[model samples]
Target: MGSVTTSHELFEVRRIAIIGAGPSGLAAAKYLIAEDSYEQLDVYEQQPEVGGVWFYSPEIVGVTPVPHTTPRGPPELPIWPKGSPAPLFSNPMYQHLNTNIPKPLMQYSDQNFDSQSRLFPSRQDVQTYLIKYSQDVRHLIKFFTQVADVHLVSKDGKDHWELTSRSIITEEQKTVEYDAVIVANGHYSVPFIPAVQGIEAFNAAYPSTIIHSKAYRSPDAFKNNKVIVIGSAASGLDIGTQISKVCRKPLLNSVKTSSELKLEQENKEEVPPIAEYLVDERAVRFEDGRIEKDIDAIVYCTGYLYSYPFLKSMEPPIVTNGRRVRDTYEQLFHINHPTLAFTALPQKSIPFPLSEAQAAAIAKVWANKLALPSKLKMIEFEEKRIEELGDGAGFHVLGFPNDARYINFMYDWVKTANDGFAKEPARWGSELVHLRERYQEVRKKFVEAGGQAKTLEELGFEFSLKY
Candidate 1:
């Protein structure tokens, strides 16, 4: 970590580098561009175009199920034969996926989805929307560039970042220096499959049968097969529901919570977490002493780890157990090194708007228009957060009302930091909060009605001034 004893030298940000051309990275670029103080702003993306994970390819990344034993750092990009096109990074977007959050709440503040688009737009719709949103700063993005390492360096007694990025296709590398860095690369890259008892042997018995949600492309592969879907989160439920239509009757849904056990869906039955795998019997033993035999596939819909193999150089590491980012203040700025910040770290929240809010705050602070609390104060905030939320993934889990409050808080924070020239940040008013509160219900109604509703009003969700 770089040491800064004075405030004047700490916030002297001019040339900034943003990693990832995803929604969060694009938002960061827009806000940073709005601030005329930055001398240079570069957005690095490994993919050929924008839209991060939403930029889907039929090709899926190979699964690495063990989290603890897995090597740290970004996975090495696959090399193609000379003159061949480089393969794209595998994304979690499946064929039949749609936004769980409605377009009204999911969109960035400055843009709206096409009027003809559904209330919960499809995967391709979002990819197109993000590409369109990135038009203004397209010239600033360096596509096909993968940042391999980011380290803190000292020059002229001031702290700066030395970044090394490699070309995914050419296998060429380049190193550059910047005043600050924003790690907006997103966290869904590395899939997190929990260590289950006898899963390795199970995989040996049924090769390619145990898989993570990242590798899932279509439900057709699971058709007429006995399937067990693990984890009951958004992806788990969505994937399980999609498979139930084609899989064997009563698709087994494994969950860790009693609340999720009550999830009622036709052709799907909630089951306890897996206890052991009976390799010889080709069966799974549940925690409740029930064994389900002849299981064809076990899809771990478990979430991803927060990985930044590039930040391996940082002292007092940021990532641990791939669960949550540590030493972050308000889950954005680094406490010891305030200039180093992150966006879209919170899970179970509206991503697009949340990215904008975080980018706005980071931009304001980096531009010297907004002041951050002292290092001691920032450290205290994180300590309090860990005490309240505990550690691991829960440290960054901002669900429902917390997500609403966070965006609004960023709005107010940036408003106070405004120098009369900054663009207005996204403000979550009572109506937006109300809509967000009932997002699941609205999405459920839409899905139940065949997902044909083109607008919230069409789904009977009206925009009201009153809560």
Candidate 2:
């Protein structure tokens, strides 16, 4: 919030500053470079290399460690400290962790996976792809540089963004001005740990016994230990199952709290929500009045929060709370000053392709080739969205079918804007759209079919039902 302007005319955006060198940042650089209007593009990344959260670092340093807590079972990761400085280290990408989505669905619109790669590639494969993509626009990136602050300055009836960055090694500070800023810093670093009633007592009794999933690196560390995995989401289930192979007895504590909980039912599976912790007996008490003793460790699979400490220093802070951003139109451009800044497309959508579409669309808007909805219309959209989804988590959460709608909007915009009017920014073709639709259709059918069927040989059937 620098100088308030009454005019909504398109401003000439020649120089752009992109924060973070992750997929979104790289995609922004790619599209902006493709457009001839943008002359100078700068990408700032905190890490020594290109991959933002994908690059796995062995050492755990400069991290905002999960604080102590007390709970019935294991403690949740503490709330992200608002207005706090960025940690020195990055989020952990465990060794055996693989992509949850298939390679075909996760690939960028313009890029393809390696021919020899598997369907669900490893984290290393994704990091490699990001690195290769970074190489395509390496000239624009300033490695080992961290963006400290971004301030809005109005000069001669126009808005300009001034970004201050510091080198991680030498600690030298420098400030540069740009016509626009793209917050490409992805939301995987700062963990969102829930609070528990008796977590502090438990942590004091058993030091280093409870940890967040971000601290988990390998199953070897949990071997012969009695582990309790909190949450039943993808990471929680996958990590718990992996540790169960080596651990003495690993219990999966699901907060789903549903009577209709459906699972294959492994040997040591318990489905009660945690009620409280028994510090005296060092046991876990569930809501069902059952007590579990001799529990060794707990792993929290709670996700990360969208924390941008850098934006707090702005004239008027961009992030209102831990929940959502303020005055963002379509979750992309700033409603008041559309030209000043934009938060890259968010939610649980296909990362690379969604980023590609968003980057292209943003480039169009910055180039004055495309127009956004009226300010009143934009505010109405956000209000209606919050009404349907509720506040905070509900607002940002995008499920399967909803993701299709969002991406399709970007695709449609790219197509409509390029209809013989302005030079076309790279278009996300029908191929990607078709892939999402077909993937959703197949997934729906598969989910409805429920658990996997036994092989024909095991069932002793003459013919398969799939045929």
lDDT of each: 0.84, 0.67
TM-score of each: 0.95, 0.83
lDDT string, candidate 1, 278-386, tens digits: 8998999999999999999889988888888998978878886778888888999987777788999999899988998888888888877788887778889999988
**Model 2, range 1-467, lDDT digits (tens) per residue?**
44443226765789999998888888888877876678889999877678777877655543334442211121112222346333245366888876655566677765666755544567888898888778878887887787877777888777788899887667799999999899988766656666666766777787777788887888898789777887766677567767877888535555654312223335247557667777888878777788877788878777766667666555455655456666677778777777654544467677776777778787877887777777788889888888898767667777566776676677678666643323232333455445554543333333335413222122222321110
Q: lDDT, candidate 2, residue 26?
A: 88
User: lDDT: which candidate is best?
Assistant: 1
Model 1: how far residue 208 lies from native, Å: 0.8
- Backbone clashes in model 1, listed as residue pairs: none
Per-candidate clashes, comma-separated:
0, 12
